[model samples]
Target: MNATLVAVVLSLFSAVAYAAAAVAQERLASRTSDSGVVRLLGSGAWWWSVTLNGSAALLHVAALKYGPLTLVQPLGALTLVAAVPLGARVAGRRVSAVEWRGTALTLAGLAALLVTASGPAPDDVLSVPEALAVAGITAAVIGALSRPGTRPGLRHATASGLASGVASALTQTVTVAATDRSGPLLSAQVIGVALLVAAFAAGGLLLAQTAYRGGLGAPLAVVTLANPVAAAIIGLALLGEGLRGGAAGLLLALAGATVAARGVVTLSRPVPEPAQLPTKEPEEHPIAAELSEEEHPVAAVLALNPQSASYEPVLIPRQPAPAHLTPL
Candidate 1:
């Protein structure tokens, strides 16, 4: 079989594995409130998700070995394509039309972005200093985004993407070294880079899992888009892979990014009001419940009966002031 054909087959299966992993992560996230690493590691389901992710990563690496970057990278967008429907099925919900639209937009935009961004497979590896710089920068970015904030899931997804991208870059260095028999395997440099790669990869997985706590579609899309873009940025900066098609390519890339961003925004939008079930009425406060309608009609009305109203104020009987309580 042609290597390209093998790569195609591997990429497709890799996408499926990745999609399944996302679904598993999302389901676990929905069931658990805590996204703590310790809590996640303890769960059988979470570990299963991690297994699926590892399988996907292995398949992806195999696919790359068999094919070119341009072919393999675009195929990766299929993870989002697979994830939307897969996540909906797992959650026992129908895929909303809005989700479909968002998915389409995201895929189309990502395709454009990948087409322009991907060039020849980069052979260059990061120097020790460069690797350290990349690791430090990626860590800082992930830390900043993972902090408590609005759109926590999206923030975490972006962090996940950045971490994954850096890991990919670092992995390239280690893989290249391993492939070249001329160099001694297990050198200190290789060991150090490999460790960095492992750290970032683990961090990425944790962040991706946390991203799913908000819901599935938007966070997944964000991760999908951000990952390649981050890697491409590194490639352009360090590996001599320039954006294709010159100025036109740059314009197209920007447009694609905008469209993808719009799609993510669409996916993140709250469900239509009509589809949401009415929320339960708030429980009465204990003090409010203790007030009687007659004795404290106003308080009772305000707390227990929104429709009722009274102007009368409760009158306390005048009692002789205690010596200490008297006005100075």
Candidate 2:
């Protein structure tokens, strides 16, 4: 297979893996009472989710090795596409029309962005000091986001998505550096990048689980939107990548991104009320009414004899036969 084709396949597989992991994490979140890290660590479902995520990261790295960030990163949006149906299946709910529309819009926007993206540039290796600085800044941001009072909603999920994006960008950088080098993989640069990858990946997983607690749409959307943008920014700034059509291409990409973001927001909106079913008035049964009246006749008897302590036989005196009967 062509290297580009291989990368595309791997990227798609990675997206599916990510989608499965998101579904698993959401399931685990819904069932667990304790949201603590320790509790999550102990959960089997959580472990399964972790395993899926690990596979996804590995596949993504493989894809990055052969493909440009512009191609591979935008394709990752398919995770959101895959997740909607999977999540709906797991929850036993049908995907609403609005959700379907949102999904279409999101897909369309991503397609537009992908088409307008620039081709890959030559890889640039980061120096040890630059790598360390990046790692430090990423760690600090993640730490601040993980602090208490962040609340478990859009804010928290967005933070998590941002962390995940940083992880992805770093992963690409590290993969390129490690693969391009002819020497041993344990070089200082490679090792530093590896450690940052581990730290960021782990942090992203935890935050993603946290985000799942706030439902799949918003956090997933935020992550979906942030990840590629972050990768593209890093690629453009650090690497020598450039858009195809210069200013026009950049504007088109931006517009597409905006549309995609709007779709995500729409997808994340609260579910609309289900279609109302017509209600039928209960049919009255005459026999049932009679049975009810027979079952509670004490009230009627009490009304007739209010003075009586309880229901008993009441006798009336009978008069003697009429007088004036002739003797036989």
**CA lDDT, every model vs. true structure:** 0.76, 0.75
lDDT per residue as tens, model 1, 296-322: 323333233344664533333234558
How far residue 79's Cα lies from its native spot in candidate 1, in Å, is 2.2
lDDT of candidate 2 at residue 287, scale 0 to 100 = 35
Best by lDDT: 1
**Tens digits of per-residue lDDT for model 2 on 41-88?**
888898999999999999998887777777778877888878888888
Report residue 5 deviation for candidate 1 (angstroms): 6.8
What residue runs in model 1 are displaced by over 4 Å at the alpha carbon? 1-9, 64-75, 148-152, 270-328
Per-model clash counts, in order, read: 0, 0
Worst 10 residues of 2 by lDDT: 294-303
Estimate the overall C-alpha local distance difference test score of candidate 2. 0.75
